[model samples]
Target: MDGDEQLLRGRVYGHDHDDPDPGPKAGRTYAELVGGPLDGLLLDIHGWRTEEVDDGVALTTELSRWPGGRALYDPRPGEPRAAGPGIACRFYYSGDTP
Candidate 1:
């Protein structure tokens, strides 16, 4: 991985059960991710080379359609603390093991 890729990789916060507070802030609101209008919103999942709409409602609905997949919110760093952090959705798929 190159320097830029490494920096972007550093932004991704993988699932951590032990640590209560992962480095990135959890996105709880749609407005937090997309600034103003929801139209033409795009989400990019680093390393995975995938992008989707940055809509909370749409994402939640889509997540439920997946058999064993779920979505998570990971905030970006070095933004205005008060304005709330920008979020990137991370989806995880665990094969049927129930």
Candidate 2:
């Protein structure tokens, strides 16, 4: 496929780079990213566990300082919605992962 096509299918953090208005996809649930560089990004949590969502997750992003690096994202201070609807929760970008 072409670059644009690849970007659509290879989205990270639920963001389609080519799409102007990227948000939570229909029929799919996601967690909205809050602070840091990855703010406003959505993370798909189709089959995540409570601990995984409560603890946090590391998301791969090209925006990291190092190549193929991942960014640490944690849920909001008091909003741990592992069973919420649509945008289940919000994960804030903490830092880059080694």
Q: Pick the candidate with the highest TM-score.
A: 2
lDDT of 2 by residue, 1-98 (tens): 77323333323474568877565555566776667657766678867887788888877777776657888888776765646446666788788865
lDDT of 1 by residue, 2-98 (tens): 7323323222223243555433334421122232222223333323322232222223323233534333333343332222233334222222211
Q: Rate the local accuracy (lDDT) of all candidates.
A: 0.30, 0.67
Best lDDT among the predictions, by candidate number: 2
Q: List clashing residue pairs in candidate 1.
A: none
Error of 2 at 23 (Å): 4.3
lDDT of candidate model 1 versus the reference: 0.30
Clashing pairs in 2: none
